[model samples]
Target: MKAKYRRRFGFKATKNGPALQSTIVKACASVVIPALNEAKRIQEVVAYALADPATDEVIVIDDSSIDNTAMLARQAGALVVTSSMLGKGTSMRDGAAAAIQDIVVYLDGDLANLRPGIITSLCLPLLNNEADFVKARFGRGGGRVTELTAKPMLKVFFPELAHLAQPLGGIIAARRSLLQALTFEDGYGVDVGLLVDAYLAGAQLAEVDIGSLEHDSQPLHDLTFMANEVSRVIFNRAKLAGRLHVEQVIAMYESQRQVTAGIDYVLSLRKGRRCLLLLDMDGTITPSRFALELARITGNEAALMQMLDTPHDDAITRSERIAGLFRFVHKQQFEQTARSLEIRPGVVELVNQARRAGFMVGVVSDSYFIAAEIIRRRIFADFALAHTLTFEGDVCNGQLQINSAFLPDDDDADAPICKSNVLRCVLADKTPPPVELIWAVGDNLNDLEMLRLADNAFVIDPKSPKLSEEPGIAVINAFTDLVKLLGHEANLVDQK
Candidate 1:
């Protein structure tokens, strides 16, 4: 009966039964290429792969490429596997399985600028046990996503990987031990997914410069899709590692609340006592909710939320994240849409009233000076402390040149214009030493530390639900409520 079934199915029966066996042959190294319509570039890439002395074999998986990619790769001395399904992730998995070497190197087919050195650079770290995985970095041709998405995400969630630049670069090499243990996602996010997986798997990773290599640039419409996939990979890895706990999530939310409440209390007391009031534009007076709105408009809401969920530690530089934010804004042209943003109601009136009360009212927001200047002039603010954006003629240079004076030095001083430091400066320059009271209000996690240092805290309409749990924090639904709480007539004109 078994023989008859085998004959009917066109299967050859062997003496060792038909069960799948663990094929674990080990060679020096194997190069795997997941090619899709790369007939013209496959040969050159294969030649580059073969040039490395450590490379014992090359495997190319053609995922139903419309071109003669498989034929070309086979002709170039590579073992080709034809995959019925498409996707770089699936092709990579197929190629990895076919690799007979202890070390596996994966390279993209479109690397027209391919050189022999890249293979060595990718494989050396893995071969020497210095790293279980190696990522490639090109001097001139790296993707903007590396600087904007991967680096910032790493800086926030996994600070150890922050120093490993180009965390999302496609070219990588790893030991077979590590490759077999990972779960590769099928999409443009495969590279980032792999890095996060490796990190969570306790594999040491390093980045190596592979010289300059050119590839196609993705369109703006593709960014949201790419960001979503990348975020999925990151969140999945974090979840698998038990890093995203409910308690920690709650704490982050509460911190945001405490800070917001603290800011409100300080501002309210100052308004009552006729003291000068200064507020930071971003995350202070005006909420950072505009970014969320922009993300919603651009269809990147999921990606933005994922980023907001990541736990940021001190190791991550705020400057780098700020740079990423600027890039994100420029890419979406969100600044042009600022006129439509909704401010916390009564903020303008609060500024005006404070000024009328003999207070030097102004803003100290981290928003671009140009944008803040518009708000400053409109509200008749006395001064604005903001970063000046660098521009070439009329166009933006996409780089933020923060004034050096704002950066904190090593003399037991914090950032020169940080919320607490700014408040201190205002007190020293304008008010008597040991002023009656210092009040501050805000609405995000970033404001928590500064709020804790203040005499009173007030939480406003908060984005995070955790704020409700903060001890001794006064919560208000509207800015007018704050005015009433401060023993002043409600400013109904600015009410939303």
Candidate 2:
């Protein structure tokens, strides 16, 4: 289905027109600010944009601010556009219309610690033809949730965007050619919507550190609204990109929300009992495509497997080989392909059952965090350990950076994460005491360590190519058979 709202301000195409084309050969650069009640900081924001020589024009769209934001922006030599519609999206649209330049830079007006260099840092990539889009990152900001939540969420579900550091940040720069083609959501979701849309439209993107900036931290009370808006933006983009099926979208939403709500409730209960449920990504929750898919997209799949599959006695050499494979696949294509993967049947039911059984579910995988996050969101797993991707703007640096907590130390013997390490961590974190019953599941050789660590382990749909063949691990063809194995009632599963 087509998006309900369309871009009205930018270049419009006529019916049966011979493709829309740009009028300007060289796109001028404009800085667009969507301001609300930023009377104190609007002028500083305008000044920063104007100070950059590359920025030809500054357009500030006031979203019905009761404060003197428009007046302040005008005083700073910016062209002011007032919008009665009252939203960041509407303001952006108005600003885009007033812009004479083909390259637009959007900045939040409430930054108290705004730096002049940020303007140049954000716009330079787009101006020099290095990237089609740029996202700004600050040293001191309330973007921890964004880094931990949104970015990882995008990486897993929208792998094409796995490289974007601040997907929901208020600051961005994009070429008019790409900006005009996007449908912006008119709420808290606008930033994320733009990022996903631009990436899906095949724009080369990157993020740059603007040093540091301080802003009002969102209170814990606002998380629900943020999550809803973020989810809406992600789901809509996924639907548009054909990564998400319409019917399954509803189920996906329900399953995710339920898992999150369940976790919240479980944490609140303060139960002393602690149980751990370790999950595998590739084939257990979703279909395994990392090897073949990476090969097909990057043309380096064989080389990647050789590095991973070969008997590497040297840890450093093994790490280098894996990193080399990631370097070959462009972040955008990797994400797009990952999103197209399908989840296993009855996976949600199994997760809900596990949650009800008082198991503290978490994922331990050698895969990228973005890939692990997809499983986490799909099943509402509490935590995940995976590889990290370094991003400058929207594009990746092609470096495979692992999370420090998951990294192996010099003294550690059994590779970085022997399933025993994951088990020990979970067991140690239990509030009262670790539960006697612990269950782990997997389908690959990577899971062998964890499976051995668990009190009981289930190997689901194992491929013949895998190396390990542990005797204690019960083989299950389908996840639906889990309830019977665990002696649970089928009706107890939370379908919602």
Candidate 3:
């Protein structure tokens, strides 16, 4: 993308006398840019900020960008500082701390159509004593998030500031004193929070037009998280002001509960050799539910319910109790029951498609290894990880041995023996793939953590009520839908 970069020279005092100039200033100003994986556009932005003679320094806060953003920014004559993976708010504050100037101007790094003199326009109001903090208003106005979320919340909580346009614009300039006096929000709420706090603190605020500005919009999956954080900060501030009743607060939480969160399908042309595809065996790959099948076959449906209903401290104890109920059933009978369960439609096709797409498919389940392995062999999966059931002379024993691989490490003892731990073991190989390249498919309560851990997950069973309601997970009605989903992803990669 081409951007306009205007070159301007420093102001020179005439021989006659010093004249009042509003276009240029002699005071020092620090332009701070918070960047993450913005290597393509950071250089242009850094050069633009340094072109102004009033700018004494340019600082780019690298927020743990995986790309070469820091190196490129330094090449463009900007001081680079590394920061934690907290978010943009932390980056901005860290950059401010490293600055030496009293006046600070913040600009985004990923603008495709940024015009000339944006920094000057934002800082001029603050320099002329017309405003304590100035926010930029550019062409093509507010985004969908600002219009749908921030504006309505502002109208209710901050009516006096409702008339302003693009309240969440990141381009801003403020005095050191005013900037230090405000608290920064953690995520997407930072921009709007600063504006609200500044107005409430009795500081003069101004909005300046900086012409047309364009940048990338976040994917739909990320917008859900943004909306949650933005809503949280706004409501917390409202409650602190004593503007909400106790019942109202409870209702608000109930209304906007974040049940599920899905990952963005990032499009990339780079192909890797291996991808860990974790599939849940019980309700996911098979049509019949595991526990229900066991209960029906053993004629102990009431006993199974009693064991399940009894409260336990952790997953290990719960699994032990559930396994103890099947002491009398023979190993052969259990295997027969497992094989009788019908495989979900499109099971083989999806697995084959993933293999052709360069994925190492495996089964990570909470069921017994005997049954999981049987299904794995039938479908020709690469690997299987599950609990081991003990048997002597073809007779099933009451004792159940939990898979050591599923156990949590010493650092986190309380963590459940969930599929995520199995995933961790898979990733501990000599050449493990990054989390972004991993994909998961599962259905049930135990699969929740694993679904959240993978880059993108598919909940392939419609009967799973708990998993279906969760946000961020892509809940599909049938296993056939996965073929289409993966095909779409492949097409996107091909286009890129």
Candidate 4:
């Protein structure tokens, strides 16, 4: 998807470029390039920044480069400063501190092919006061780590940021005041973490089309380390914002480490044609039941139980009423609690096994998007579908937006949100691979339609005694049993 700017306070563009240029002169920008052993490309990048009319100064943070990167930057007309051999985050902090201009523009030193006028373009939004922070989006497609790790997590937790084509892009410009107040995450996450912090702090954020950017891609093995640090920063921010507790952050970090380590193992295995692997997020994927933490935190277990028992006539109504219970609960509290839940022991193994066996593993849940996507990344699901909750900064505003993909077909106002429709739509779209059979797994009444629609369905809800004897539904005590089921099916397909 193309990156769209998320402007607050209804900013409108004026046809007064001359006037805006005047403002740029007043608010001088210092272009800061953080470098590490970029002797070949630093000179050109530095020259481009220096030539921009809006820029009053240029600073390069040489991160303990053993080469002549610092000397080259100085020769190219930039103030060079040395940073400790720590990480990019440290360089960013040090560079910002050394800047004397009102705005700071951060550009990667290794950009081999940078378009002219890109620096001036990135500074316009800040000069006119339309944005306090601006991220540059270029024409090149983002990397695999972006598509695989960063995008999914952003879609789930920070939906407002989903439109950004390159959330991890190092080309960004922000007000010096905002930059000073923000925390810089070390390594690969510095870019994404800055964007998230800016958005959550209610800063006017914009992304400019900076034409095309060309830079060298990292080696395959190094990408795993990059993904780990990036994922850690994403979760670490949530913890600092009170969206996740300390234990939850540690658990998430450890799980992602396993994900990185197992990347080679999963890719080396031969994958097959498409089959279906549908999963539910709340209790089926995790240990505890749904919304149990919310009730416990607010001391409203009785209220929660009443809402569950007192069914509203329609899905919208039911969702709206349930959301009302969280109005008093801060979004941070809700998110932190959700992150604290641990996944089932064999869940990740099952997902990896399914993928290696040519199954299209997807999470289809009636739960909110944040929880669904977070769990999806932990287990490495291909895609996910879930409802979105609205939030202002760090607080939920008691409003819920149901996913239009799963909305009921008819005009029955009282009808519930049906996952069966979404499942059918997904199956229809998988035409090339042609899904031979579907396997649905869930733990509650909300999954009834989906379970019935699947070729094979399993009820893993230990608490639901009523579903134990349901016809055509298999009841399983442990998720590890799916390995046997898949193995048996593989034999049948082989015979065919």
Index of the highest-lDDT prediction = 4
Error of 1 at 449 (Å): 37
Q: lDDT order of candidates, best first?
A: 4, 3, 2, 1
RMSD of each: 22.2, 17.1, 18.1, 12.1
lDDT string, candidate 3, 1-496, tens digits? 0122233322234432111232346546899999999999999788878765557789999998999999999988899998655689888888777888878999899976565556666777787899998889874336556655665566666667767778888998988788788888779999888887888788999998876676777888988888777777777777766665565544343222111000000011112435557788887899776666877888978987776787654667877877888887887788887788888888878888877766667777787877776787777676667776665545667777777667777799977676787667555532212333577888777788888888778787645687777787888777677776675554444444
> Mind sharing the TM-score for model 1?
0.48
Model 2 per-residue lDDT at 153: 55
Off by over 4 Å in 1: 1-27, 140-142, 245-496
Q: Against the true structure, what is each candidate's TM-score?
A: 0.48, 0.48, 0.47, 0.48
**Each candidate's lDDT (Cα)?**
0.60, 0.65, 0.71, 0.73
Q: Per-residue alpha-carbon lDDT of model 1 for 397-420, expressed as tens digits?
A: 446655332344457555444555
Task: List candidate 4 stretches off by more than 4 Å.
Answer: 1-27, 242-496
